[model samples]
Target chain A: MSDKKISTAVIKRLPRYYRYLGELLENDIVRISSNELSQRMGVTASQIRQDLNNFGGFGQQGYGYNVNHLYKEIAKILGLENHYSVIIIGSGNLGQALANYTDFEKRGFVVKGLFDVNPRLVGISVRGMDVQDMDQLKDFVVENNIDIAILTVPKTKAPAIANDLCEWGIRGIWNFAPVDLQISNFDVVVENVHLSESLMTLSYRIKDSY
Target chain B: MSDKKISTAVIKRLPRYYRYLGELLENDIVRISSNELSQRMGVTASQIRQDLNNFGGFGQQGYGYNVNHLYKEIAKILGLENHYSVIIIGSGNLGQALANYTDFEKRGFVVKGLFDVNPRLVGISVRGMDVQDMDQLKDFVVENNIDIAILTVPKTKAPAIANDLCEWGIRGIWNFAPVDLQISNFDVVVENVHLSESLMTLSYRIKDSY
Candidate 1:
């Protein structure tokens, strides 16, 4: 609609809306009112209407939203149609697990390569891709047009590797490292996955429920 | 603090504050003002004050908050010292990876055992713990007094398995399964780790930045 930038909170919620709409689409649900969608999503109906309105109303005044159409629009906004060439730095347990995760392939994130510093792990194959040596990282990224680097390295090593990845022109980072990465100057986008934080939140919820 | 219950938004942010304070404690930073914490956490100073005030004012007038004191308080609120015994269902790549994740142990979650339906994987060891047969899951959980079950099973099998876990008296579930579990008439807590959702959010952020 307007040229105004979307708020970060709205941006964060778009994926959730996409996921819920996808489920509705799969279940052959053609349309959903804001109230119905909000009930399923555990959010207020007014909030749902406000969020969708930011992206040019996909819903009708009374008939509500077309599930398939809304899902497509959200997917397009999320860049899910753009096939991103991704590489994992650090062939550790988390790295290998993510490499073996088949869900990414269906969502336009292709794991092109996995890199590691350990020589023993270097030549090893993970999910049909050989773990390339760390020395080959820069060249591999440059040649393969890898835009995303998934960092699962140890906390001590994460910062240096993140810097290296950024230097090699990596546009995005999905960092699972314990420490927050320090990338100041670059236009790179980062998504930090702090597993402990999630667990802590869970613990709090469990405690609160009791 | 008033008798009013803390909102879910404030509950979700407690862990992040705990984490930031932990880092400050590690760095021997004794005290931090709300403004300083807000800058590092990317939140407004007033928001930080409001969040902290929900628990009880940890900050003093003019004199900043003590990092160690705040960290301990948050950890207490999160029930981190409860020592929850955890079991992983489905010893696949994700399960094994999480089993080997040593971070959970430090945060009071102990990985007691891993389970799988595959007979071949039953006798196998993951992160030094033997993978148990699916039949042994209930007995193992009961014997160990397990509180949390990590579901890494396939999407199709997730709902049934989650139901089984809940029926067996499991208190909390850290679900990595793609499908959202439908559990009613139970006191169980669930925290879904939707990997695709996270990636989609990242994709949206990247797309928006460009």
Candidate 2:
């Protein structure tokens, strides 16, 4: 199943499935049919079945899927069981918020450090973690097995910082900067969280509703 | 074009197109072929054509699309020119970051106020806007004609706050809460920014790269 080719669309839906299944697990639901799960997820039942089948169908012919098993399977597929050591590249408000966000720890992403170029912010402590100077980033990455770097720096600074992170051996980047970081030459994987794009999406929906 | 029904997938892509076209406009790229635009966007030329055609075919048969014209069209479709008066429901780190984010103003979303239940946070100023009390939310919204509510409240408090916003005649909600808001009964539009989902997506991309 891991070797099987999965479409980007299917991959995108995995987190939603993981989330819904997590909710079901919390509710102590033992099993659920494709129909029920699809209804809950606002997707078609057949589409749900097709997506699950992409990763070797966990659902049975009639008994449906075991909620806990399915959730665990999705979690494993998402690499949530493998704890990731993370660092925030910018100690701005968003970075600070993310560092304080305790939910990441429950899902295996442990933020190790926060870094900033601002002298005023360098000594500040956020959520029990002291902000380190950007100059120390490479050494810290080498010392700590940093799996991901969350980029929250200003747009002007994002590209250079992203390049530095890549050169320093960061495996993944969760970029919150407005600019798209072009560092494809390195082996680093990136996920750009364009907050403005999300806002535009919401605006479109609002306009459509009218 | 406005009357035509657009799929959610196409609607989602509009922002990406808008962003790309904006960059092109900045570079003074007046006209671009579908193939060139497709290469830049990582989508098929035909798909790009299809998307634009859905919105009245902004591109010519041979000359392709006029960058500035295309961008303005997308902006119109997204309702970006119409200024939306917004308020942040929580003044936490994320909320503060958003309130201070000046880019949204350029995109036509004006931050009217920030609201909080905590007495300590209320009356505090953020990005020149005073944090208003939660009790004053309804009156403020009415007086200011607030169109959107940015929900950065705790997950436990999100649902009730969302319901309250909907009842108070808010047209749209940009939810940053971790929870999947269930508010279908009301006529309000919602766009949930599940930061964890984005993290999971990044994790998956990293795992796949490995």
- Please name the candidate that would achieve the greatest DockQ relative to the true structure: 2
Which consecutive 10 residues in model 1 chain A have the weakest lDDT in total?
Answer: A178-187
In model 2, the number of clashes is 0
Task: For model 1, report DockQ.
Answer: 0.71
Candidate 2 is graded, for docking, as medium
The DockQ values of the predictions, listed in order, are: 0.71, 0.78
Please give the lDDT score at residue B105 for candidate 2. Answer: 92
Residues A72-154 of candidate 1: C-alpha lDDT, one tens digit per residue:
87788889989999999988777888998887988899999999999889999998889999899989998988889899888
RMSD for all candidates, in order, please: 2.9, 2.8
Off by over 4 Å in 1: A1-7, A27-50, A53-64, B1-7, B28-64
